[model samples]
Target chain A: MAVTRPGGPVDGSSPDAVSIAVPERASTGPVVARALRLLEAFSDERPTLTLSEISRRSGVPLSTAHRLVAALETWGAVERDPAGRYQVGLRLWEVGALAPRGPGLRERALPYLEDLCAVTRENVQLAVREDDEIVYVERLAGTQAVGVHIRVGGRWAMTATGVGLVLLAHAPPDVVERVLEGPFTRHTPWTLTDPARIRETLAAVRTRGYAVSERQITSDATSVAAPVRDATGEVVAALSVVAHHGNPPVSVLAPLVRTSAGGVSHALAAGRRPRRPR
Target chain B: MAVTRPGGPVDGSSPDAVSIAVPERASTGPVVARALRLLEAFSDERPTLTLSEISRRSGVPLSTAHRLVAALETWGAVERDPAGRYQVGLRLWEVGALAPRGPGLRERALPYLEDLCAVTRENVQLAVREDDEIVYVERLAGTQAVGVHIRVGGRWAMTATGVGLVLLAHAPPDVVERVLEGPFTRHTPWTLTDPARIRETLAAVRTRGYAVSERQITSDATSVAAPVRDATGEVVAALSVVAHHGNPPVSVLAPLVRTSAGGVSHALAAGRRPRRPR
Candidate 1:
């Protein structure tokens, strides 16, 4: 009989929630890669794991998993509960908070994101592209707004959300091509899967300075997104607002999302510039 | 001449911004500890560092630093920029988001935090104690609220702020004793320095189920804090609201803080209890 883990994805079926691709190890030695694989084993769906579960998920021998996990626990990369289950630790979170693309970007954009959420009373999301997928950096829920399945640090396909579209549109040609290739998961009937249509949508996003995703992820919600640029004018992130479908036209939200994105870009540029000499 | 790194503390001076303690090695081999030390070298003041700088700050030999940094880069724990400066990478941030005591707690407490900030128009902070220091997990700044220096993942002394006092008050006796034996830095004239006074304050915090810090961290701010308990009734976190001095009496904020904390406690309890069989 197969042992079942509480939150593990069922066999032969992808988890319908946030879909994050585990980072592939490059030239790192096997020991380091194995340690990282252990870290990757914990996810939004399965935040805690037993030693045997970690060994199985990471594809490391049980003894190796035990040794690596012991090191990780010592270094505070992972913590063990009273019941001996392992989860990521606070020290790792503190170091990760220094990531320029993660908390740093979110910190610079938060005031504007809060402003957008307050003004529209809708869900505001900030995301950046990692590989071909979009990783949500921050999300502010509008208290009484439409329920959203997305969470911070969650990942989704580039064809299924407004932020994803904006990021894919500004991504390099190779990345765009890679994402537009076959094998897309269809979240809803409205999710854009046709390569030609997705290409056309990317072009329109470039022309309009924003993207509108209508009932792509869920039937009751629509999202509008715009690109956030850095000092070099490269689009580094995407900002979006998801609201109840048909309550406000996409045209109405486009300007708000664009303005917020611009505000974030300006803040980023200002922060990057050196102070003038006295 | 001493070579100064960007984020290293100046002679006899503390970096007043974010203070994150480096994790100590716990009987793990020296290599893992050394890699963790390299990560600890990056801070809010110096988010990016050159290879030589990392070597110097972490006190690792250049060849070993290069090897370990290469591994870290491969594992996406660190990333290099065009200028060859290394910073914390997005993959690590994604993993860190799984920490139960960090983003997990913050995610559950955010809506209530937003509501408190909306109603009070004050700086709201959620924090948990790690070792003897207070690590801020979330801080929601109200528009037009008093400016605050605390950031998420930043650490502060257990005697310095409202949330810190609440957490310290409920902490184990040895931890409290360790904090009280400190050569405390006085940020303001009103900061409590006498151990007797601090003990009284702790007792008062326990009795009242709240704490009020008047001009402790900054002269212009007054903070009211309450404890957040888990399902087991353990004080796992603290919630606080910092406002401009003299704007609202501590009495007015105390009840609000306690209520929001209770709401969070209830939410945590509800989340932890096993669901009844359908």
Candidate 2:
């Protein structure tokens, strides 16, 4: 029986998450790729897994899974639980903390994100683009903030959320054209699936230096977002605040979001090594 | 001419940083271990490195270093920059976010941590014990807080900092014994290196439900700490606030730290899977 997944891996379905474009492996690259794929088998929902479960989920044989897991455990990437199941290790987290776009960015933006969450009592988010999707770097939730389903490192479509739109709007022209072409998944009735409407939204974001996404995920929520720039003025990230729609006008929220984004931009510019664009 | 190599494989005469005890490895495990050793070559002072630099510092053969770096790059544990230097990658950081002792604990405690930082404007820290060393998981810096040279993932002795003392106080008896018997490193004149004094401090922390470490690391700074418990009431982590020793007396800071610790403990207990003892 086909089962539903929260952040499902591609089995030719669930186009809302990151697309799996399996790279051709004629090199040792595929072994490393397969090893990482095995790690992806364990998530926030199923943080611990048995050998068979890992093999089944990753499409690797039981023996292959065992060997890979053993290698990972030895390298301190994966760890074994008392129940003989495997979970992500502390060592992996340590190395991952060094990721420039992940915790490295979160460290600088956190205080400003905290301020945004406090002043508005809303859900504040920081995100960067990864391939065709957006990955949340930091998420700050106020005590009374609307519940958000997004988690750090969780991926979402570039068409759905406020941070996503701000990032997508600032992405290279080719990236914009590619995302505008097709395969947009609708999350709610208000999700902008029409390429023309999305195009208009992107244009507005670029012109006004902010984006407002209304009820894209849930009918009760609206998001206001602004771009965070680096020293060279490249939009390295997007900062956003999501709150209940109709309670406060987007115009009232735009200045706060823009100010927070500016704070993050200044912090990034001050702390990071000079960015030589790829 | 070999300039005095800092952080090299050689043992040092200085008594500051602990001597790295690298196990003799003649096997594949050692090869992997050596590769990881290269990662230790990067520090807070130097977050990026060149290939030749890594080889020289790690004391690995150029070819071996290249092979291992290839493997690390393939796994997305590291990435090369336009300058041909390597830096940590976001994929690794994503996996690191799953670490229960690190981001897992931080994510749960962040809201409470923010509250503490907001109310007190003091430097708040969260730490866990790794062996006998205290590894800071989160540190929220308040604008006017006393300057403390601690960073996330940075390590300190279990005898000095407030969070360190709280963790050391609750550690297993054998771990305590090892620390007490140690040729302890001293930071300031006021640091408590005497085993009996440490014992008394631990007893006080247990009895009084909080710890006040005064002038341990810096002469101008004092820290107030409290233990954070899981659902089973076992001490899982420690939360502390660092401030100038004079104002905001330890007595005042004690209650704030304890209250924030309680809030974090509640949030941790409410999680789907409370962290099991490591």
Candidate 3:
């Protein structure tokens, strides 16, 4: 709803060095931010960490980290591993499953996504725009030669991915401007880093009802994406099929991807039982 | 790792009146607990709540709720809906997906779970033990006259469902004792609530290598489950298939369910990629 709320923690950065962590900045840091710092310290790269590591990474004093972690463990937000190290907890996962923009959307779109994955035999992906970045909601790997390396919760800039293009096309104007005025990351020689070229690509995506990214993220894959809309006729997400480079031409794959996206939109519009939380 | 760490916030209670909320109890409430209270305020029934609702539900002061929510929002643990009401956030979902006992285990076991679901065309479930309860990790619905109402992340006592029984049979002695010395909940007339009968049932499960619950949760559904083990051969989770009562019979479903659970155990022991987080 609102990235419009606060700006410090969700930038996908390890905010271990939070603004309040400076001793001179505040004699006593806000406990809430320190708690969040403890959470931010746990990442995909390091799923389990010792209490000492937590204190070091979060920049909260060892004793403060101990007290805060005690509170977190009480809430089932932080759990210990077999080795007495901390990891994310299943209780937190249970609550996270309630996130409307994450699993809530993913669960509704899964059947259609699976259908596309089955029909295409190519990497099928679903993503939603968050601020200027696109976060993958679900991805079904195809049995094709080109196997995608992106995971379900992975994030990527809007410049090099297919779903990212479709989402960027429907994003707010300010978001578009923010993405355009970027220090674009170049993944390959064919990757689009030029702002003008990306602008041209957006128009083509709108006109053709899909997006194509050939040899962008990987030299072996070509991605075609389409927008998935909600009942309000707003594009809430994007779906794509990343196929082996030109094996199934974009012309052949585009309709399949668009149809799947449309099916997901239809499911969203139908107001079906969306794997309702119990 | 250690529910052994703390005990106040996660009894699945709203905890609106945390111990520190009493003015006489503490001059300053722990802000970490207060922030967690704000999180506990959101539920499946009330996935989106206003600032005032949060304050009321958390029992945190109005200004304090405002401050804590700002921090939660910044960390992507909470988000504002289109109507400006708060719901869980995608970043939180991303972090939660890293939980080993939840999605990590489920992702590894999914292929086998799907195989059972497709072959039997019956509801398939995967669950793990949490204290004296079972928490569903994933559930694939089947097209049958007897449809299960349980949702993923839903919890049940170790007495009601097949997965629960299997998990409980393999539980620690103290946990077993804790469950047995209980005012057991009976979901149906067929549900076994007597301690001696439950102990007999546990022996049967260990001997037969599967657990069967007939018309326990619902009259029309009969569930059969098998234990899934880790490399150490510990029962880490349970797998099940809830079928139309007496249709496939426990005889037919048991072997299939056991095979699938074994498959999952094999996958786990392999130290597989496990839908490796990016």
lDDT of 3 at B251: 85
lDDT of 1 at B233: 91
Q: Mind giving the per-residue lDDT tens digits that candidate 2 earns over B1-278?
A: 11123211112223332333221111223334555666766665666789888888888656556766777787767787545788776767776777777777887897789899999998899998877888889888886799887778878898888998899889999999999997787889999989999999999999999989999888999999999998778898999999998679987899999999999999877867543211
Pitting candidate 1 against candidate 2, the one with the higher TM-score is: 1
TM-score of chain A of 1: 0.87
Model number 2 iRMSD:
18.5
Model 3, TM vs. native: 0.85
Q: What would the per-residue lDDT of candidate 2 be over residues A55-95, giving only the tens digit for each residue? A: 99999767556656776787777777545788887667766
Residue by residue across B1-278, what tens digits does model 1's lDDT show? 01133311111122222222111111113445567778998998899999999999998667567766877888889997546799999989999999999998887898789899999988899999989899999998787688788888999998989999999999999999999998898989999899999999999999999999999878999899999998889999999999988887887899999999999999888875322111
Per-residue lDDT tens digits of candidate 1, residues A1-278? 01123221111122222221211111113445567778988987788899999999888667657767877888899997646789999989999999999998888898899899999998899999988899999998786578788878878898889999999999999999899896788878888889999999999999999999999988889999999998889999999999888878887899999999999999988966232111
Which model scores highest in lDDT?
1
| Order of models, best DockQ first | 3, 1, 2
RMSD of each: 12.5, 12.8, 8.3
lDDT (Cα, 0-100) at A168 in candidate 1: 96
User: Estimated TM-score per prediction?
Assistant: 0.84, 0.78, 0.85
lDDT, candidates in the order shown: 0.82, 0.77, 0.80
The Cα error of candidate 2 at residue A165, in Å, is 2.1
Model 3 per-residue lDDT tens digits across residues B146-231: 66877787788888889989999999999999999988878789988899999999989999999999998778888999999988
